[model samples]
Target: MADTEHSSKNVTEVSTDQQSNQSSKVEFSEEEEMLITMVYNLVGERWSLIAGRIPGRTAEEIEKYWNSRHSTSE
Candidate 1:
């Protein structure tokens, strides 16, 4: 019983780590970046509006991406 419990715990931990890794490695194509910048220029930081124009991207993700991109440039 203890061995089974330990094995299950390890499996859960590994899966959780994999999920985090996947989520942290989001990549945006150059076209997506250009669209994001264009929309941002038109609407300012209205992330949801920008996201609406870019399929598969959430407002939070766009905001995070914008912040990271700008931060590194500055």
Candidate 2:
């Protein structure tokens, strides 16, 4: 009975950890994509200012996404 209870507690903790990781993933809406593209075209990779225009997105995420997409090409 103690082992079973400990197993259940570990499962709960693991589930919470998974949820926390999932929450950290940044999802972009269509409007956000449009805004990112428009701003990218105009300002040319100013991630901080671009992120400022986007709600719920940090400049680091913006930079990471852009780099993931464009770094190979450049």
Off by over 4 Å in 1: 72-74
The estimated TM-scores of all candidates read: 0.72, 0.57
Candidate 2 residues 12-34, lDDT tens each?
Answer: 99999999777557677788878
**For each predicted model, how many residue pairs clash, with residues at least 3 apart or on different chains?**
0, 0
lDDT of 1 by residue, 1-74 (tens): 99999999999999999998888678999999999999999999999999999999999889988987887652
TM-score of 1: 0.72
Q: What's model 2's overall lDDT?
A: 0.84
Off by over 4 Å in 2: 1-25
Model 1 misses residue 23 by how many Å? Answer: 2.0
